[model samples]
Target chain A: MVSIRDVAKAAGVSTATVARVLNGGTPVSPDRTERVLRAVQELDYVSNGVAASLSRGRTGLLGLLVSDIANPFTAQVARGLEDEAVRHGYQVLIASSDFDSEREAQVLASFARRTVDAVALLSSSGVGEGVARLIRNGIPTVFVDRRPPDLGEIPLVRTDSLSAAREAVRYLIDLGHTDLGMISGPAGMPTAAQRLAGFREACATAGLVVRPKCVREGFLGTQGGYTAMCEVLDLPVRPTAVFSFNNVLAIGALEAVRERDVRIPADLSLVTFDDTDLFPFVDPPITAIEQPAYDIGAEAGKLLFARIDGAETAGTDVVLPTRFHVRGSCDRPGR
Target chain B: MVSIRDVAKAAGVSTATVARVLNGGTPVSPDRTERVLRAVQELDYVSNGVAASLSRGRTGLLGLLVSDIANPFTAQVARGLEDEAVRHGYQVLIASSDFDSEREAQVLASFARRTVDAVALLSSSGVGEGVARLIRNGIPTVFVDRRPPDLGEIPLVRTDSLSAAREAVRYLIDLGHTDLGMISGPAGMPTAAQRLAGFREACATAGLVVRPKCVREGFLGTQGGYTAMCEVLDLPVRPTAVFSFNNVLAIGALEAVRERDVRIPADLSLVTFDDTDLFPFVDPPITAIEQPAYDIGAEAGKLLFARIDGAETAGTDVVLPTRFHVRGSCDRPGR
Candidate 1:
């Protein structure tokens, strides 16, 4: 509650002198500046952000929107974004839409109303049009983990989902598994579609047919994966190997197999996408496609800051690569 | 970019008419309100937050400070806070201090300067005085996860760490283990202290001696846990049972034990604090204390909003319970 007048009174100086010292206006005598600083600290004077922001026409706040905050993958990316944003002297305002397009739009509109300096969106459910409107209104936006089809000139950071899926499938294939099934995320998601495309491409290149009955699409949570795995297990010719599009799906599949008393590798080989630090501890350590989630988040943050700093050029897209980690889960089929 | 004037002109109404329609002040003719709404949609007009805030003397922005964001426990809590804040018509700005008191102070100052309506802090490093100052300045402040000493009448939401730790240790003792080791978090953290106290109490009640060499203190991360486990393994009388303060430590111990080729439960029973969804998938599913992190976050957020809504006697501490989940990691000795 210390005002400039209080600091001035404590420092034996005029209010104008204190203001000058604080704002660096017309270089004050060094001794006087020191006295004012001491008084300010002693009084615990805090600047009024409303007055400062009104004078400057901008606040040091950036908005971040994600599809779901509970997902480990999104949470990791958010951590990276927050770390980078803090380092750059910006604060992040976060909102989650639960993968609903209308909710995503509402969140974006809210951010726009707040007039955040920039926005970082992880819009897996395709709310590009809402983002386009923000860009048109001169709000800098950077998409993370999900890229829009027509966002050719907008800034985006995403993992190479197609390549990651291909590598994951290839790892299982290399382990001498022929009968393969896939548990994909919701069909409308770009990342899921890309992964499925990669899986089919890998199968075709290996002279194998991707059976229609071997794929199921649903939510990306553990239950979704569980239900998908159950469907796959019901097939007369159940696959000896399976590639799950995300970590939650892989976990669900693992649970299903364990409940059914199926021994890993001997009965089934599994590979998952989007590996995290926790995966190594799984029963039989899962072989997984590890994307650069942290890197993608950091890069997206950097890009958004650049745009906020008046980079007028159309933003570019960045696709980080994935690493295939081979572990206890993906062994030779029937080993 | 569209202003009220532009909307009024486009809608063929006076500016005051447009303003009335937007603010719902007075009964605007329904036809005129419709026209104004149509013009706003067509022009894609976004409200100017700066102008509105300046006029109202408040911004609908809340600040959230966390010691660490990458930790699954912290991340889940953050998700709950975000969900509740959004529902209550507030936006959350987040900062991570990595348990550094200085960094936390800086973030608090920054949030104060941004004129945030309130702040919710997950202060694991114990610096409540700074936040108390903000509250004195009329900024509503709420603490989560870690309670600071003498936060006289300030609000806080935390889990029952003492009881949780007691349950974990008692579970190990019931399995017929006497020689116990513990991996504690940094010395000053209240949660760590409470858990340690609970562990000692359990030992005393069970007539077991506490060995000084069996306790290690550091950040609750994988590396810290791994190094602590190494030290415990080197002890002349290695513990038959171990309790980790968090999941990161549990994971680190898992890797260390794997490297040492020591079998879990059979050689050393282990229980960790803060159960995560990932635990169930682990090779030997980790036994853990499940803190109600999401509830704590949601409650803190709700308390903050209640304070903001002019609650006369708002600052109250809320403590939730933790549940013990026994899994494969803790079993009868020599299983």
Candidate 2:
């Protein structure tokens, strides 16, 4: 029920000053800006300002395709993309592929038919063919999260999965976990390949012998993690520590450990590749590498917009850094 | 990389049959449909069909405005909506309102400017004015999750927050928790109002004291929940239990409880209004009312499409059921 007038009155500012703060293109004084913002938040006043006139023939629509929306990581990336796209006067039409490569291709084709101004793909697995088609058609596309192996000149916005993975592995090794195990995605996917590379490099560098049984193939899915974890648990020599390469895997691995009566950081240590709010709330708060999904999304949107604006330089790969959030899950590995 | 020909060959169907199965124009027999689907899944084939030549003059875009995308519940709803929309040969342009009514209005206006065919307004706190404007503008709008009070005959697709909330509160009281508190969203918001109504009605029916101190105002935000939980913990007679009516609030409430060393289900029983996959992994996995968000989304998409297809009828309010998922968090009240 609160209006701009009410906000203006509350802040002792004019309606124009309030408008200037709410919408860009006009500027207000520092004190006025602060007062207007505070008044807006206090009054919960939403401006009915229409977006600046969109460029003609530009539908002002961008296409975003992800493997899954239910995944917290993917959803966060999507939030970042949607927020940034809206800021640039573009609305995003998001499609989920459910990790199905074919569905991914179909979604892209649908986007093409809709004639979106540009596209942002989040770390595709089986959809490289669809992406190739997009590139062949000359549509502005930005790869996010994971890039295709042969995407020679495509701009990519991804987190440093390799270094983060390596550091996490190294951290576990430092904690005296010589016999460590990893639950990883299918070996063929680019993100999976990079993560696996990190795991191998870290183990090899630390003079730790990573037997073939210690590395289990997973689909980056909960069930995949459960099955893989069970395999590791049934091995003759139980791993002193486990590093799940993604969120769902971590969840499944934890469930397996719980089922087996294995205590985290006591009987075994744990490290997960991705982090979520849930991690902090869980028992033995999980140690994880926080993938900055939002930043990747924001950066992808910026790159896509730049291409739409006719940025003609070769593709720029924006590799955002990852951070390690250590909690009670990882500790010294007892004999 | 799998082509229609390959799928047809693998499934022992003609190319036309494969096309008919993937695209909805012509219905294929059950046997052929099964074969085609299996072939598609096995081969990882994605049909690049351009959505069955959508009706000319139809923009083939539906606008979905939600309060938050980062929220798991919202994200799941979005996934369901996107999947259903895709099946119907439409794509969704999603915008997050961040529970701000003003931003909701602006996003609707932008959707209008872009000529999206119809819209699905997800549960939100502050955008009735914008929604009303859309209704007046005669753009097909289906209110999702939260419907505006006094809005004449606006179709709504929502989970039953009222009955479910009442039952949850009553369930706790049945276990002998005479004292109770609730973390509720801001007043005057439709969803918040409904939930609060349920809480009050339940307490009154049970002859429990409905003191103002038992109710804490929150924004359905993490900070809101944190502040409200702090207040509730400081209450002279802290309630035997607390029900956080939303996800973030529940998280904040749990954190506060943990900080205070309040043993869940022993010192204080806890119940949250929504469920996420993360709940189970946490210690004393949260007991929650699981809102079937995917069904709501899928149904909303169907309704919007029906409206778009010119189904003239009175507004339909489809209220889905909510199921209680009790974990280790809720039990008999103890000293």
Top-scoring candidate (TM-score): 1
Off by over 4 Å in 2: A1-55, B1-55
- Deviation in angstroms for B128 in model 2? 3.3
Q: Number of the top candidate by DockQ?
A: 1
Model 2 residue B209 distance off true place after TM-score fit, in angstroms? 0.4
- Please estimate how well model 1 matches the true structure, expressed as its whole-model Cα lDDT: 0.81
True contacts kept of each: 0.78, 0.51
**B1-335, model 1: which lDDT tens digit per residue?**
67778998999999889878877758998899999999998998877777777677678777888866778788778878877887887767777787778888888877666468888888667676677667767888888887677675778788888888988899889989888999898898888899999899999999999899999885667888898898887787789999998888888878789888888878898999989887887878888889888888888888888888888535576989888888888777773
Tens digit per residue, CA lDDT, model 1, A232-293 = 88788888888898987887877788787888777888888888787887878888888787
Residue A318 error, candidate 1, Å: 1.7
In model 1, the runs with Cα more than 4 Å from the true position are A1-20, A23-26, A30-43, A312-315, B5-17, B313-315
DockQ numbers for every candidate?
0.67, 0.25
